[model samples]
Target: MFFSCKPAEMANLMEDEVFMAFTTYAAIVILKMMLMAPLTAYYRITRGSYANEEDVSRKSAEEKKKLLKAHPDVERARRCHQNDLENVIPFMLIGLLYALTGPELSAALLHFRLFAGCRIFHTISYITVLPQPSRGLSWILGMLVTFSMAYRVLSTVLLL
Candidate 1:
């Protein structure tokens, strides 16, 4: 008699909670990259300090201020993207840990979507030169999302 053989089951990362967070991370990263496109165009058209330069990261704060003074739109884009870099990273990291802890899909989606959505709106508001409270609200909302996830993870660890 011949023995029957079965193939091992392949786990789909898409179904993993951490992968959900990772996909969200990718979206945020890509969103930030797309935000830079217009910034680059503005820089090139306005001839900002680092536009033609090979090394864009060596500029001192003074040089940056000069560019800002010369091109207000570029400054807006710069600040918008810089703020994203500061905020998005922590959100992604904490979110990954939070998801791995087996947070509900709805909860994870809430955290991921709200933060990314707020970030998009935040950048849009900045680039359009919107008033303070609206832009401020977006930043606050994103912070709250990240903080909530952090609390969830921390609370879980503390209980353990």
Candidate 2:
């Protein structure tokens, strides 16, 4: 048996509802993460803070020096993006493996939806400077969802 599923079985698994839900939520979170780059740029442009020489190439030396200073808004957007990189990439990889583990559709949807929702909430809280527990809670909850999926994947695979 190949991963305990024959080729025909694997083909059917590809069409599984649980796997489809995983892909949809995975795409949502991935797109949300990608948008952070533009959000960071928006903050940088509006706040007159440029991180690189190329970003301020047209400006005079004095202007360049002024633009080079860090802005809290830009930093917040960047940190959110960075956090996405740390969290979402693992979710994608582990999610793919988890989907292949033949989990129930409802259980997989709960995992996928919670993760996507938490990430979106995290971005919103970070950008709007929402109070402490909001951002922290979103991060913790999202991480928990990913970890839960990972545990499921491990348990399922180990059984084989």
Candidate 3:
């Protein structure tokens, strides 16, 4: 009994506002990342671009060759999705540890919201072919937020 909290105490932990906020933002970013696959497919289908020969098997040989080439828009979508993989995975891992560290709810929410917002903006800027600094700034800001959360986790936890 000494090692375990009571059920009500466990419920309290589950209800923690910081953790709750983290979960909400985590799910939002994750869902957004997941949707990038379909978005990429949509871009490919609309643009007649396919990476694999098999994907254009139904077309004429010459058509297949043309379809297999990369389109600029498709490449943009693909790169945006790839960038999401890089940034979001780190946010999920570090955000979990950061949540467990019991940061102030407001501060945690700010971090989570900023990251999510920045990511969404990053995708829009990339896909819409916004000017250079738009996408670049969003990416850097989101990365900074993740780094901030990581710093909090490292500072709060006991070092090995």
Q: Provide the global lDDT of candidate 2 against the true structure.
A: 0.92
TM-score of decoy 2 = 0.92
Question: What does candidate 1's lDDT look like per residue over 45-155, in tens digits?
Answer: 566644334344466767655544346676677777778788888887787677656677778887888888888888879888888898999999999999999999888
RMSD after Cα superposition, model 2? 2.0
User: TM-scores of all models?
Assistant: 0.71, 0.92, 0.92
Each prediction's Cα lDDT score?
0.72, 0.92, 0.92
* Runs with alpha carbons beyond 4 Å of true place in candidate 3: 1-10
Tell me model 3's lDDT, rounded to 2 decimals. Answer: 0.92
Q: Give the alpha carbon lDDT tens digit for every residue of 12-118 in model 3.
A: 87798987899999999999999999999999999989999889888999898789899999999999999999999999999988988889999999999999999
Query: What does each candidate score in C-alpha RMSD?
Result: 8.0, 2.0, 2.6
Candidate with the larger TM-score of 1 and 2: 2
Residue 22's lDDT within candidate 2 is 87
lDDT pick, better of 1 and 3: 3
In the predicted model 3, the residue pairs found to clash are none
The sequence of per-residue lDDT tens digits that candidate 2 reaches over residues 103-126 is 888899989999999999999999
